[model samples]
Target: MRRAMTDQLSGRLVEGGHRLDVRVYFEDTDFSGVVYHARYLHFLERGRTDFLRLHGIGHRALMDGAFGEPMAFAVRRMEIEFLRPARIDDVLQVETRTALLGGARVVLDQRILRDGEVLVEAAVKVAVISPDGRPRRMPPAVAERLGAPAS
Candidate 1:
């Protein structure tokens, strides 16, 4: 399919968020052949990472002080719900959206779906921190870029 032929590595930015296509691998499952519970976190992380990447935010650049003083994004909290199991070889779509973004914190809503069925969902809270691990207010420009209302 033409759609499948594009950007096989990472997903693109959608109207209000990001959608990434991920294929379940053998390693993602346990002996029962269902995806391991912990594995869902990895999938969620990838979606969030790629969401920022597509939005022009890079980890390396952040550490290099691209936005101002060197800083990094760190997960402060996460609440996940595993609704269904996904077997190996299943194609999953990880959707990520910014629920709230301001000052030094961001709350992201992420969902993992298989054929439009939600398999897992999460509410992730991330904090902006300095290299020394102290919380810091995100730079204004960076916040503006990420906090912009989705079209």
Candidate 2:
């Protein structure tokens, strides 16, 4: 309870159905002076990772399992829109929403914002897989915690 309250106040952790903010760095930009298109993908990935972390899902644990098999998630598809441009040192925020949760897939809606302006938007699809790269069902406990599958 106390930890929850603190995280809420500090903005390091978010509540259920929440948004997390992240800043953009020079390394995220390209020689063209604007954020590279691929950089947006990185931002979205971080947003999803943070969302899961805040919800107590340790990605490392999933990857480095006790059975010596590295569980992983792979991006299967993405639809992105570049609404605006972002530059070096821009303090951008990646807003993430859990759009869908499935037995073997997760979909995320993410937006990169700068001072209330949308720079980019994306819908990303990810599939969970075993070390051998075979699709796997998401753990029941994790699924229950993330709420029902998107219908």
TM-score of each: 0.92, 0.80
Q: How would you encode candidate 2's per-residue C-alpha lDDT over 36-66 as one tens digit per residue?
A: 8898888777777777767666588778773
Give the Cα lDDT of each candidate: 0.89, 0.75
Candidate 1 lDDT over residue span 1-151, tens digit each:
6545544566988888999999999999999889999999999999998888777788899999999899999999999998999999999999998888878888899999999999998999999999999999989877776764543
Top candidate by TM-score: 1
Displacement of the residue 132 alpha carbon in candidate 2, Å: 0.7
Evaluated at residue 130, the lDDT of candidate 2 is 90
Which residue pairs clash in candidate 1? none
> lDDT (0-100) at residue 17 of candidate 1?
90
lDDT of 1 at 76: 96
Q: The CA-based lDDT of model 2 is what?
A: 0.75
